[model samples]
Target chain A: MALCQTSVLKVYHAVIEDVITNVRDAFLDEGVDEQVLQEMKQIWRNKLLASKAVELSPDSSDGSHPPPIVANNPKSNKAANAKAKKAAAATAVTSQPQIGGSSSASSLVALKSSAGMAAGSGMKNGLVPIKQEVNSQNPPPLHPTSGAALLQKQQQAASSGQGSIPIVATLDPNRIMPVNITLPSPAGSASSESRVLTIQVPASALQENQLTQILTAHLISSIMSLPTTLASSVLQQHVNAALSSANHQKNLAASKQLDGALDSSDEDESEESDDNIDNDDDDDLDKDDDEDVEHEDAAEEEPLNSEDDVTDEDSAEMFDTDNVIVCQYDKITRSRNKWKFYLKDGIMNMRGKDYVFQKSNGDAEW
Target chain B: MSYQLYRNTTLGNTLQESLDELIQYGQITPGLAFKVLLQFDKSINNALNQRVKARVTFKAGKLNTYRFCDNVWTLMLNDVEFREVHEFVKVDKVKIVACDGKSGEF
Candidate 1:
C-alpha cells in the first residue's frame, strides 16, 4: 500500500496496541491481579474514547495531547502494521501525574488551617473547588456551576454500567512506603505459609484514593500468590489505617477551623476598635458571636463515623457489601470457602476464632 | 505481627515523648495525650510533608529501631534511623503538635 501511494486511511494499530500494552504492563508491574487488571483495562479503554471525544487545542496541553486523528471509537482501528519509522511520528505520550502534591509543609499547614476554617464556619462556597484548583495542574477552568454539572455527568455515567472511578497513583520506588503490609495466602491451599510483605510505603504526594487502589491491587496480587490465613485481617487493618488517618484529619481540620474563626474575629474586633466610627460594628459583632458559638460546637464535635465499619453499610446479607473478599484455606481437609472475618477495634478477627499477636514470637495465632 | 506490636510500642513511646514535650512546652494539655495518640498517624502524614530519610536497624536482643530525619526534624527509636518515623525529638513536637505541627495553644 505504501509503495502504491501515500495512504491516510490505513490505521496504525500497533501504536494504539503499544499504548494499551504499556498500560497493562504498568498495572501488572504494580501488582494488579487479573480480574482487577481487566477492570482497569476497561476503564482505560473508556478513557481513551473519552479523550478522543474531546480534541484539545495545541494551546490547551503540551505532551499529553492525543494524535490529530480522533477516532469516534478508540477501538475502531485494527491496523496490522505500524512501521518503526512511523512510530516516533505517532508516539503515544505518558500522562503526567494527575494529582499534585502540596508544595511544602508550610503550604500544607495553610491548607489545613483553611480546611479547618471551611469546616468550622460552614462556608459552603468555594472550599472544594479552591482545594482542587490548588492541587490540580490542569484543573479544567471550571466555574462552580460547570464543575457541578461535570460532577453530575460523571455520577450519571458511573451509575450506568461504569465501574469505580479510576484512581491513578505514581510510586517513587526510590522512596519506600513507610508501612509494612502483609499479604494473603494462595487460594485453596492445604498448608499455611508465612510470607511477610513490607510494601514500600507510597509517599505523601500520592492522595488517599490513589493509595487505596495501589494497596488493593497489591493485596490482590499477594492473595493470589500465597497461601495466607490472614487475608481479611490484612485488608481490614490496611483499610482501617487509611480510614483512621482520614478521620483524624477531619477532626484536626475541624479544630483548626474553629481556631481560625476565633482568630479572625479577634482581628476584626481589633480593627473595629481602630475605626470607632464604623456603625456596622454592632451587626458584625452579633454575626461573629453566632459564628463563634457554632465554631465552638464544631470544634468539640466528633467525626461522623464513630463505628469503624470501613464501608459503613448496616446490612449483613451480602459478602460484597464490605467490599472485602476472604478465601478460607483448610489445612486438614484441604478445602477452601468464603471465610467470614470481621474487624473489631480495627483488629481483624476470624469468626469463632480469637486472633492474637504473639508479641515475643512476632507471629499471629488464631 | 510482632513488628506491628513493636512498631506500636515505639510509636507509643515517641508519642509519649511528643505529648510530654508539648505539655511541658505548654502547647497542649496533658489529658489530651490519649486523643493525640489516637490520631498519631495524622502527625505522621504532616511530617511526611518534609523531605525525610528513614533507616531500619536490628540488634542482638531482637531489637528493631526505626529512624526518620528531615532538615528541621529528626525522630528515632533505639538510635536507628526513621526516614519517616514521625517521632518527637528529645524536645521538638513536630509530630505531636496539633493543627499545623506548630502550636498547642489550640
Candidate 2:
C-alpha cells in the first residue's frame, strides 16, 4: 500500500510538471512582438529593483519582511509613479547620445550584474528575477500580451511554499515623440490685403423680439467704424433704397390722379342726364332720336376730355401735395410715404417743401 | 507684353468686347489689379435670376479678362476686387466682375 501511494504521488507530480510546461510553451508560441516583450522585461526589472530598495528601508514593518526603500508606499504610490515616469522620460531623452557610445556598454554591464544579484536572492529575500526570465522566454501563445501570465506567475510563486515574500511587477510606460510641420502662405502682399474680422455675439445680446433692432445697431456700429472709402459703398446702398421708395410714391400719385379724373367724368355724366330731362319735355316726339344723337356725341367727346382731364389732374396733384414724410436717423434710416419727394443723384430731392413732415415717429408703429 | 485677342463671331459679344477693350486700353493687365461694375436692366435681371447660377471664367492672353455671373459680363483679374464689386452690386439682380492679378478667378 505504501509503495502504491508513493507511485501515485510520483505520477501526480509528473502530471503537474507537464501541465506547467504546456502552459509555458503555449505562452511562447503566442509570439508577442519583440519591442513589447523587451518593454515588459524592463518594467519587471524596475519593479524588482523598487521592491529591493523598499526592503532595505527601515520605516516599514509589515511583519512579513522589511520592504525595499525604492518600493513606493501605498499612500504615495500614484504620485511617486508619475514622478518616476517623468524622470524616466527625461532620462531617455538625455540618454539618446549614450545609446551610440561606451556609456551604453557600461549600462548593459551594470544591468547584467543587477540581474544576477536579483536571481541569486531567490523568493526568501522576495527577489524573483528568474521567474520573470522564465515567463519572458516561454510566454503563453493564447495570451502573449495579456496580464494573465503575470497573474499566474504570482499565484505560482505564492503556492510554491515560499513564506510571506512579497512579489512585485511593473506596468507598461507610455512614450510620445515630438513632430514639426509648416503651412503655406496666402496670396497677395501683406500691405494690400484685407483682414477678415469675425465677431461672435451672444444670444443674450439679441433679447426677445428685438433681433432686428440689435442687428441694425451692431451693423451700424461696424459700418461707422470703417474707413470712409469703404463706408461710402455701404452708404450708397441707402440711396438705392430711397430711390425705390420714391418710385413707389410716384406710382401711387399717378393712380390717385386717375381715380380723381374718373370721379369728375362721372359728375359730368350726371349733369348731362339732367339736361336731357329738361329737353325731353320740350320735344317728346323727337326725344328718342335726340337722345341717340346726344349719346354718340358724348362717346366721341369722352376720350378726348378724359385725356385732357388726366393731364390737368396730374398737374394739380403735383402742386396740391399734402403728404407726410417719416425719416429715420439713427441705426437704420428710412423714409415712409414721402410722395412729394424724389430721389435724384444720390439725394432725396424734395419737389414740394410744404409736404415735408416736421415731426417724426418711430418705425415700430409700421 | 501686349497680345491681340481674336474672335470668330460677335453673338453675345458685347460684354466680352467691352472687357477686351478695357484690357487693350491698359485699364487692366494680368498682374495689375482693378474693380469692375456691371448693371443689369430689370428685364435681364428677372430673366437670368430665374434661370442661371453665377460662375466666373478667365481667358488669358497678353491681358486676361474674367467672365462672371452666368458668363454675361467680363472684368479684370483680381479676386479681391471681384469680391468687392460683388458686394456692391445686388447679386440677385446685377452681376459685378473684377479681379486682382494674384489669385485668378473663384
Tens-digit lDDT track of model 1 for A1-366: 111011101111122233334444444554544454343234333333243322223343444433324522332231212233235444532221112222233443334323333322221221111111111222322332222222322222223312322221233423433333322223344333424433323343122322322232223444444333355455446554654454354344455543433344454434332332122222222232335434654446424333434345533222222111011111111114211111111111122111111010110111
Show model 2 residue runs off by greater than 4 Å: A1-282, A316-323, A326-366, B1-106
Which one is best on TM-score?
1
TM-score of each: 0.15, 0.12
True lDDT of residue A302, candidate 2: 71
Model 2 agreement with the true structure over A1-366: per-residue lDDT tens digits? 122112222322232233233333333444423343232223322332242211222322344432333432431364456558768988998887544443345443333223222222323333222122223334332432222322333334333314434332221111111111010111222332222222222222111111111112123334434554454455335323433433343343333333322233433333332332222111221222223334544554577668887999985543332211111111222245211111100000012111111111111111
Candidate that would win on lDDT? 1
